[model samples]
Target: MTASLVLAGFGFGSVAAQEDATTPRATLRIVHGISGGPEVDVLLNGEVLAEAVPFGTVSEFMPVAPGDYVIQVVPTGQPAEAAIVQADLTVEGARSYIVVALGTPDAPEGRVYEVNLDEMTTGMARGRFINAAPDAGGLDLVVAGGEPLFGDVGYGDASDYIDLPPGTSSLDLRGDDDQVVSPIADVTIEESLAYEMVAVGQVADGSLTMLTLSTAVDPSCSAALGLGGAIEDACVRLTHVAPDSADVDVHVNDVVVAEGLTFATVTEFVMLPSGEAQIFSVTAAGSPIEEALITTDLGLDPGQAYEVLVTGDTEDLQLAITGIDLRPVPAGQARLGVIHASPDAGPVNIRLSDGTAVVEGLDFRGVSEYKAIDEGTYELQLSPAGDDQSVLLTSELQVTASIVYDIVVVGRPESQTLAIVVLTAPVPVQAEAIASPVASPGATPVDASGG
Candidate 1:
């Protein structure tokens, strides 16, 4: 064998031994000054040679082939754009190297501003602190670039001030219960601006709550009622019924119809035309319900349909008056058709209240076909719930004993608004039947002479 003493390179054959021996390895240490750590990765010839190491931690890898290699140090979970440091280093076989990872530059913390309200007058200027995030709590209020305005109070209840600034300004509200800060609310300060700070919790409450009572009638005949006629005047009664007393106000078309009605509960009234439709709104002090107007003037005609709606503050409470058709029936009785539309698709209770007793046993769902009701001076009301529930409609209807009449109740799509239409026949009829029922039933029938 000519004494061919094969010199195994590290127990490998000579050909492969030279290649394995020439391979070079590197070790890197990534460091960061911030609380979050940095990640480290080693590459050979632009190819990743090992798994990434945890940030702010040290990791070791096997020797890599000696050549120009790149070392990358990046923040964990961040892309290459977020790489804190990067370097290209040359490694020789059997040699060791160390790399130090650097951290990103620090960002400045935000400062707070102080609002003083010591000189503000109560009731003269109403003030309250609202967070940008409706659900967030505690926010810190302090003097910009200065110590906290309120000592020891930090950014909690004592930090915010209201009704002090002579003008309105954006304010940051910190929650006392948690580390939540409200987005800025444009607070108008008309009284004093440079006084002691007021806690958000101490602000006066001025929110409004609304209750609605609605009913529908034939638009053609009822349209005249909305114009304020004695024959078509209607009223909606909203009772607070809540244990706590409230200041109630009623509005129609943004006009204040009633205000400052203080009671444990309240009753509101709205007038609608006999063949017209409209929206009514009720507001109660210190409630979250917004003041809104219901729609009247539903474009209804004979043989057409419409709806009337009543909505509550709670999302779960909604009432719809649907399937209202206007037609001319005989005098003594009027044809009234209505459907209670609800998401639950359940039955709705109907009641005819004469302002004293309630007539029960009336329930409907979806589309209730047209039915004839005896005409008289009556208040027609509907409630989704059987007893003492919110009213969907409350209005007076006068039916002539001999003329034909049609009433249609229509519900608005995706809204708690309703439209009522009343249709009347042109046919001449007995004057006694058309006369107001309020006149004594046994009294002599008066002639048409301006009686």
Candidate 2:
């Protein structure tokens, strides 16, 4: 009975009241899609339900005693006391459960995906997309070269399941503007199975990405439904690390990549033609540039990233180039990545609402996974990584749809230096929601997470 976070509607009801109408039987299939995480074990009321369940694993539906069982998802080989996610599930005898283990080790949670097969046409595959990317905006899941499947699937929003012909298809995730953000190729759907396409991970960092889980139809079907970081180019990131620097302009081969760079300013990952030598220039901010303050050469490599930073005093300005193996974002939606560029601030953690840690262990030159939140108002709270009470800054941002941004933390602490430099560009907007041919469950409370 360790402390656990309660999920939406993970509430209580008398087991006897639920069993009054039918026999005591419950069946469930577990879908695992946690990225940059370890294999997990599932336990029901302290009993092992499944073991060594790896990432992207879909378990066969297994029958369980229908009652008030506390469901827990623990890392494989770990004791039950270390469960990462747990829930109280009381299911009726005639019904089944599709328990999805989503989020990352950083934000793991158990979600139940429920489907009514009778509402779907016979002998067809039922599918939908659930936006569990935490920070991603509206998303669309479409079959490659085919019509759109789900559109404008917002945060915590689940599209009504649509029935598709069973076969192999290339699945791509696009932003609301319809540009392919995630190129998940070659997914095969079998006959009479229900599939849940989960969009996970950050667009900037390639972990916790998109994956589909197909569960069979029927109470006992196959146990019911079961469930790469390869960088091609060397992404380049720029930052201003000088603690007391003024707003400055940065250039690469005469191209103004960043402008008005105050202290601790950072740029989003810029795709560079890797394996070449490039020169970087720093000068005072504004168009009619004065003499460059500092110029340096960067010999970057393919399949890697280099951070070109400007640091030191006004009298002795300097350049520091550091090589890193980092991931980049794809096209489609606007990506908002972060960086720890404040040299005065040793290391810090960033959180959304001071609850979920978006970035941690972030020192100067550290980059955070691009968080893909919707185009709306969001308040980001900054605190020293582990301490809860010592809040550093509270920033409220206004983000628009389809625009990618690089939110840089700039300024020094002594002057209470804190401000944001947002670098923005528009991405493709997806088409509006295409009506699903399959009938939706009427008036029922839709659990967007499928549970």
TM values, all candidates: 0.23, 0.43
Query: What is the alpha-carbon lDDT for the whole of candidate 2?
Result: 0.60
lDDT of 2 by residue, 235-278 (tens): 45667767666878877666777779866656655554444556
Candidate 1 segments exceeding 4 Å error: 1-250, 257-282, 285-309, 317-328, 338-345, 348-369, 373-451
Worst 10 contiguous positions by lDDT, candidate 2 = 219-228
Q: lDDT of model 2 at residue 214?
A: 55
* Candidate 1 lDDT for residue 184: 35
lDDT of each: 0.33, 0.60
Scored against the true structure, residue 283 in model 2 reaches a CA lDDT of 91
